[model samples]
Target: MTTLTRTLTDTQVVAKRNLLKIVRVPEILVAVLISPIMFVLLFAYVFGGAIDPGDGTSYREFLIPGIFAQTVVFGATFTGAGIAEDMQKGIIDRFRSLPMSQSAVLAGRTLSDVVYNVLSLLIMALTGLLVGWRVRGSLLDAAAAFGLLLVFAYAVSWIMALVGVLVPSVEVINNASFIVIMPLTFVSNAFVPLDSFPPALRVFVEWNPVSTLTQACRELFGNTNPAAPVSDAWSMQNPALYTLICVVVILVVFAPLAIARYRRTSR
Candidate 1:
């Protein structure tokens, strides 16, 4: 078999192992499905009225995409934590003794988490609809929006996989990832208007990958702000393209780094 085929076959096995853990442990599903719903409720009812999303749109509409973006990015913590747990428990050593592809372990861990994110997205989409958020875009466009989210998420999962290999402690992964992810999500266009942000801060918010992801979703879902001035930044002007670029760059930079860490640290 070719190298690509060998890697893919081994990856499937690792992915299956990770997926089986989710099936055996019901609570993981509950927590993954519940938290996004809770975020929808808390933000929709509590802060919806407080945050104005311009004249034509409701805060609920604005909040849904932001929430989705935040949740997916936060989902990376699960990837990191899983890897760290495996390392802490010495499961990596056992995997190393096998003759499978070295890349399969990290590849499988990240790929399995894509399923987790997909489930979270579906649950969140249903919850958003129940709370009166609608997707006004064509079905194809909506699918593209969701595809962007999962793609970006899949790429970031590799970064977390590296962190897991390096850190090897579940508790530390959570704390360390939070310090990095929290700011990226909050300081972006997720929960608030870009106009309200000062010029200096707005620059960063406009270009932040998190913000572009949020913009791309809003445009695809037809939830954009009509009253606000049009953004001209390269990132905001062409969010879908920009988001694709970010995903590619993230994967290129992190995938090799993660695989190297897995090979070195797993042994």
Candidate 2:
């Protein structure tokens, strides 16, 4: 077989092994299933009232896409933590001693996590609907919104996976990596509009990738109130382009770095 085919075969093997492990350890799946629901409740009821959406729409409608972005970004931290755990338990060392493709192990972990992220997004979406959030866009637009979220989640997973391979301990990975992401999520237009912030903070919030993704999702979902600015720009124009650019930028920067780090660490 060709090198590319051999690599893909190994990736599939690793992915299957991880899937089996996920099945055996039901708690992992359960945690992924439950956390997003909890976030939907906590944010919608507790903080929703405090935030002004300014378009006569229920706060839940505005909050759903933001929650989706936040939850997926937060979920990525586990990618690193899981890798660290495997390394600590010598699972990674065992994989290294085998002749399997070097990049497959990390690729499998990331791919499995991407599947996990999709489930999480579905749970959040259902809960959002139950709480009176509706997608006003056409079916195609809704699908595109979801597709972009998944793409962004996958890109974030690779960056987190690199952290997993490099960090010495799961505890450190769990604590440190999320500190950066949490700020990235909250500082943006995820929970509220950027104009509401002070002039200094407004700049950071406007430029955040989370803000960009959430705005793009809002547009795709047909949240068009030109008077209702989610940021300096709320128009749906070019949302697909922006989402594509963000995905490409993230994949370009993080994917190779993650693979290189995994190969070196595994050796």
Candidate 3:
């Protein structure tokens, strides 16, 4: 078999092994899912009243997409934590002894985490709908929005994977991801309108990829008000394209770095 085919086959085997853990340890799936649902309910009811999205859009409608973006990004930490757990428990050492493709372990870990994020997203979507969130756009646009979120999340998983391989500690990876992701999601237009940010911070919010992802979702889901004026910043103006670019750039930069780190750590 060609190298590419070998890698793919090995990766699938590794991915299946990782996925089976979910079935055996169902609490992992429960923990993975509960946070997003809690966020939807808390934001939709608690902060939902205090926040104004303008454009006559209900806060729940505006909030759900942001929650979606934040949850998926946060979900990427699973990749890091899972890898760190494996490394800490000598699972990586066992994998190294196998004839499997070296990159398969990392690839499989990331691919399996995508399934976790998918399940999380589905639960969050149901929670959002129960709380009055609606997709006002065509089915195609909604699908594209969800696709963009997943792709971006996948790219982010590579970065986390690099950290995981480097640290090899589940707690450290989870805490580190929290420190970075909290600020990225909060400072963006994810939960609030762009106008709510101060001028200096506004620039960052406008350009922030998290903001772009949220904007892309809102636009595609028809959550944004047609009557409301749009942000002039190029990223916000072209969020879908910008988000796609971010995904490509992240994957390009981090995938190799993670793979390289894994090899070195395995050695």
RMSD of each: 1.2, 2.0, 1.1
**Considering summed lDDT, which 10 consecutive residues are worst modelled in model 3?**
258-267
Each model's lDDT comes to 0.91, 0.82, 0.91
lDDT of 2 by residue, 152-227 (tens): 8888888888888888888889777867797989898778766778989876776667888888888788764557
Q: Lowest lDDT 10-mer window, candidate 2?
A: 229-238
Give the Cα error of residue 144 in candidate 2, in Å. 0.7
Query: Which regions in candidate 2 have their CA more than 4 angstroms from the true location?
Result: 230-239
Displacement of residue 77 (Cα, Å) in model 3 is 0.8
After the best TM-score superposition of candidate 1, give how far the Cα of residue 211 lies from its true spot, in angstroms: 0.6
lDDT of 3 by residue, 44-100 (tens): 889988999886899999999999999999988889999999999998999988887
lDDT of 3 at 35: 96
Tally clashes: model 2: 0
